[model samples]
Target: MNSDIRQLEPKQLWNKFADLNAVPRPSKKEERVIAFMKDFGESLNLETMVDEVGNVIIKKPATPGMEDRKTVVMQSHLDMVHQKNADTDFDFDTQGIEMYVDGDWVKAKGTTLGADNGLGVATIMAILESNDIEHPAIEALFTIDEETGMTGAQGLKGGLLEGEILLNLDTEEDDEIGVGCAGGIDVTATRTYNEEDATEIKIGYTIAVKGLQGGHSGMQIHEGLGNANKIMNRLLFDGFENFGLRISEIDGGSLRNAIPRESFATIAVDAVHKEAFELEIKLLADSIKKEYKTMEPDMEVIVTSVDAPAKVMDLGVQEGLTRAIYAACNGVYRMSADIPDLVETSNNIARVIVKDGNIKIGCLTRSSVESSKMDLANMLRATFELTGCEVEFSGSYPGWTPNMDSAILKVMRALYVDLNNEEPHVAACHAGLECGILGTNYPEMDMISFGPNIKGAHSPDERAQISSAQKYWKFVLEILKQIPTK
Candidate 1:
C-alpha cells in the first residue's frame, strides 16, 4: 500500500511522504527520525546541522536565476501524534504506519496516518532534493515534538538561518492560506484518593465507550465530535447517582492534542439494584447514541459483566471527580469576534485516568488571544481545584499575530487567483502551528502557511486527500518560482 502511495501523481512529494511515514516518529521521542533526517541531509551533501534540541536543518543553495531572491525558510515539524483504536494491536514505537489508498484518500490501519505535519516534512524533503525545481536559497527547518510541545521551535535560537521569509506547510485545508494560529497550554488536574475494598454485595461490569470519530483536538473542536473521556464521565456520574456505582479502574484517551476516541472502565454496583441499573443505563446509552447519531454514527456505549476488582475508588473522591469533569468546559469556548467562522478559543478533555489511589485529568486549551487563553485556563483550574485536585498549566506558547499586509501574502493570494480562478481562504486557524514559536526569535521574518487537505488528523481515521495532494504540489512549485526578490 505504501508502494502504491509512492506511485501517486506528483511522485516526488508522495514518495518522500511514504519514506517519512515509514520511520517511527512519535512526539518527544524523535531520536530515530532525527538520525534518519541527518542521514538524508548528509546524503545530499548539503550544509546540514542539528540544533541543541534536535531540530534538523538542511540548507540548499538556490538554482540559476533565483539566487538574488530572499532566502526562504521551509519549515515543518518532524513529530506526529500517536493514537490507535482500543482493539488495534500495532505498537507506534516499533511499527511503521501501515497505510493504504481508500478511494481518493490515503489512510492508515487503525492508527494515526501522520499527515498533520508528515506531509509538510515530506514537501520540504522533496524540494530540498530537487535538481530542476527553481527556487531561492532554501533553509529546511524540521522542528521536533511540535505535537507534544513546541519545545523544538522554542529552543531554536535567532540568527541560525539567513532566510527572510518562512513558508510553513502545516495547515490542513488546501483552499486556505493560514496567516495566523492559536496558541495552547496543557491544563492538568491530578490528585490521589484512598482505595476501598470492594463490598461483597457489589457486582462488577465493564463500561466501554468506543467508535467515536476522534480527531485533532484544536482543528476539529468546532465540529461537535464526541470526546470519549467526557462520555465515560457522563455514564459514571449517572450510575453513581442511581445505583451507588463505584469505579475500580478507568483508562481513557491517549494524547493531549488528540480528542479521546474510546474509554474503558471497571465499575461495581450494588447487586440489589443490578437489574434496574442495567435497564436505566441502557436507556441512557440510547439517549447518548441518539444525541450523537448525526455526528458519531458508529459510537457505542457497552456494558458487560466482568470479574470484580479487589478495590474501588473512595466514594467521596469519585463524586467530586465526575462533577469536576462535567463542569469543566470542553469545545469552542468562544469564536473570534473579528475573524468570521474562526474558532478563537476551545478546549478538549483529552485524557482521564483513575486507578488504585490516583486520578489525573488532562486537557488542551487553545486561543488566539493570550488573555482569553489564560482566562479559560484559569476557569478550568478553579473548577478542578474546588474538587480537591491540584491544577497546573504548562507548555504555554504564544499565538501568531496575522499580518494581512505581508509581501508573500500578496504574491500567494494573486497566484491562487491566477492558477485556479478562485481566491484562497486567507485566514487564521485554531490549531497550534510552529510559526508563532519560531517568530519569537525570528521576529522580522515574513511567514505564511498552506497545505494539502487532511482529515481526521491525530486519530486512526486520519487520511490525506490524494487529489488535494496533487493540487497542493503544483501550488508549492509555483510559490517557489515566485519568491520575492531581495
Candidate 2:
C-alpha cells in the first residue's frame, strides 16, 4: 500500500482500504482475509458472527436517539478476482496487492486493484469503526468466493440477518444506482480423442494469438474486443483444410468470467505444404489485424517453427474441435425489451484446453430473463453436441427482478437529488451481482446496489477514482442518517 493513499480524503475509509491491500483475498482462498475481518469486528466490540459458509456479519447498535430507525444491512464480497499481467511475477494466493495512486485513480501494479468489492468492504469497516457518525442499527455482511462463484451467498440461511433494508455496495458507477442484475450459468463441454504417432514427413510449428484487450466477460462483452480462442480456431480451421495441419496441443484463457486474451496451439504440417502454410498464415494475420484495428490495436498472431511432437490428435477430432468452436456463441445475443441499451442475453466463450486425451471447452452465459438464459444454453448445447461432445451446466443463479416501488430506491433517489442537485441514473446491470442470490434467502429485504466509480474490474487494468470514494462515503453517511423509523 502507498503512503499517499493514507492521506486521501475520508481518512477512515482510505485507512481501512490501505489495510485491506495488505492481505491476500482471492476467491475461494480467503482464510487470511476472513480472519482479519473477525479480528477487526472483535476489536471494535461489535456483535460479530461467522456463518457456516464463511460469511462474516457484524452488528452495530444504532446511535442514541436513532434507535427507531430501520436496521440497514450493508453488504460486500470479501474475495476479489485475481488477474495479473502475463509478465508480472506475483502470486495472488500468498502475496498482498501492491497499490499506488495514478493521476486521479488508485490502481495495482500489473494486477487487478480489487476495487470492485474491496472498497465496499472498507466503507463498511469505516462505518463500523466511526464514533461520530450517526446511523440506524447496522448489519455489515462480508461474503466470500463471489468472483468464482456465489458460494457464500448461496449457503447463507434465512433469519441469519435481522435487517429489513439491504444496501449492496458492489456497483461500479458512482452516478448510477443498480436495482437489478442478470443471472448466469457455466457450461462445459468435453470430448475424447485418440492420439496417433507423428509421421517423420511432417514439421512442427506453434501458432499463438495474443495481445487482446480482454476484460470482464459480462460487462465488457459488447465492446467488440477480439477473443483469442476464437481467432486461433479460425486460423486452425483454415490450416486443417488448406495445409493438412495436425494439432498436438491446444490451450487458452484461464478464467470463465474473463474474455480470453491469449491462446496457443502446437501443430504438425506436411513437409510438402510447409512453405504454403507459412505464406497463408502471414496473409491471415494481416487480414485479422485489419479487422480489429480499432477495438484491439495490439492484437497479434505469430507462428514459430518447433521440433515435431511425438504424438498428434486424430485428424477427425482436430477438424471437429475447430468447427465446434467456430459455431459456439461468443457475444451479446439480445437487448432488453424494457430498458434501452441494456443487454438481455449474452455468452462468453471463456476457455479451451486439450489434455488427458480429451479436449474441453468452457463457457459462461448470462441473461436477465430465465427463459432467454435457457434458450441460449440450449443453443450452445446443440452446437457442441452436434460435434459429438458432451455438454453440462453448473453454478446457475437467478436474476434480481427490478421493483419500481422499492423503498430504498425512493429514499436514495430523493437523497441524491437533494445532495447533488441532479437526478442520479437508476438502472439494471448486465453483469451478475450477489443481490440476486441473497434475495432468495431473504425475500422480504429491500435491496439496492451502488458504489464509487470503478473501471476495468476482473482485469489487470482495474482502477477506482479517488474522488469518487470520498463522495461515496459522504453519500452513504447521509443515507444512513435519513433512514425511516420502523
Candidate 3:
C-alpha cells in the first residue's frame, strides 16, 4: 500500500492488482470488485456504466493529438480463477492473493496469481492514469465470470460500446498476437446407479490422489501433465477389476477448464484382502509416477481408514460406469498438423461426482474447427449412451476464423514491428476469446488480442512477468497513436 511501491511501472500495475487481490472477486462473486472499479472510475470523473450482467465499461477521452482517432475497447475479465495449493490455508473468498516478486515474475503465495486478466485490468487503469501518454479514445471493457465459463462475454448485450476496434488483453505469451481462438462447450453425462444396502463387507480404506500439478486444460493440455482424476480413476477401475474392490463413493476434478488436480474414492473390500489392496494401490501409483516421471514427479496416492458400513454400488452399475468413464475422451486428442504449433482438437475430463443416487461426469470439448468439436462431443456422448447414461449438450459458440489479411492485424503487426525489433507472432489459439462473440455484436469492428508474458494460468503456479508490462504498455501506445482517424 506504500506510494513508493505503487510508483514502480509493473509495481504500479501490481498496486491495482493488490487492490483486486484484496477483494473477493472469484467468478460469480465479483460484485465487490465491480463496485471498486466503479468507484475508481467515478473518482477519476470518467464516464462509467455497469451492465446487467456485471460488465463494466469505463470511457476516457482521447489525448490531445489523437482526439479524432477511432474508439478502441481495451477488454479484460473481472473475475479470477480461485485455485490454491492443497496445503494453503487461505480462503479465496476473503483473503488477498498473497503475491510476491519471484525474480522477474509476480506470483501468489500458494494460489493462482489472477494475472490472466488482472494484468489486463491493471494495465487499463495505468493507461487511464498516465498523464504522459498520448492515445485514442478508450473504452475499458471489463467482463465478469470468464473463468467458469464465457457467460460474461456471452451475456454482453448489443450496442453497449461505441468502440470501432477491440483489443483483448487476455492472451498469455509476450511475443504472440492471437487473432483467432477455438470455440468450446461443456458436456455432462450422468448415470443413475442404484445402491443397495449390503452386509458389512469387511471395511477397507479410501484412496486419495492429490498434490498433482493441474493446469489450464486448454493452455497446458499439450504438456502431458498428469490429470489426478484420470489417474485416480485408472487406479481405482483397474485395481477394482483385479483386487475385487467395490466403490462406496467416487469424485474428482473441479473447474471445467482446469485439469483436475485431486481425486478421492471410498471403497469397500474384504477385510482380509485390505492389505493387498493397499499395496496394489501403492504399486499402481509408483508405476504411474515412474511412467510420467518428468511430468508428475510429485504425484501421491494414499489409502486411509474410514469408519463406515458397506453401501457399495451394484456390480452391474459400477462396471458400466467405470468402463464408460475410462473409455471417455480426455486430454489433447489431436495436434494441429497444418499449424505446426497449434492444438487442433482437445478435451478435458473436467468433473465427476457421485451423490444423491446418481453419478455425473462432465467433459469440455474444444476445437478451432466446428465439426471436429462436435465430432468429439458426439463420440463421448455416444459412449455414454451406449452404457445407458443420459447426456446433455450445450449450444456451442462459433470459432473466430483467422484472416491473414485482416486490417486490424495488419495495423497491429506494423505497430509491433515499429516498436520492437522483431515482428509479432500472428496466430490462432486453442482457448476461447471474446473476439468471436464481440464480432457477432459489432460486425463492422476490427479486433485482435495481445498481452504480456503470463505463465501457469488457471493453476497455482500462475505468474506475470514484471518486465513485459512496460513492453505491453509501449506497444499499446504505439498502436493507438498509429490508428488512422475516420
Q: Which candidate is the best by lDDT?
A: 1
**Can you write out model 1's per-residue Cα lDDT over 1-486, one digit (the tens) per residue?**
789998898999989999999899999889999999999999999999999999999999999999899999999999999888877899989989999999999999999999989999999999989998999999999999999989999999998988999999999999999999999999999999999999899899999999999998999999999999999999999999988899999999889998899999999998899899999999999999999999999999999998777899988999999999999999999999999999999999998999869999999999999999999999999999999999999999999999999999999999999888999999999999999999989999999999999999998999999999999999999999999899
Cα misplacement distance, residue 143 of candidate 1 (Å): 0.3
TM-score attained by model 2 = 0.97
- Candidate 2 per-residue lDDT, tens place, 297-323, comes to 998898999998878998788788889
Task: Name the Cα RMSD for model 2.
Answer: 1.3
Pick by TM-score: 1 or 3, better one: 1
lDDT of 1: 0.94
Candidate 3 has a TM-score of 0.95
Error of 1 at 27 (Å): 0.7
Write one digit per residue (lDDT tens) for candidate 3, span 280-355. 8788888888988898888888888887545778878788878888898788877777677899889999888876
Q: In model 3, which residue pairs have backbone atoms overlapping below 3 Å?
A: none
TM-score attained by model 1: 0.99
lDDT per prediction? Answer: 0.94, 0.91, 0.83
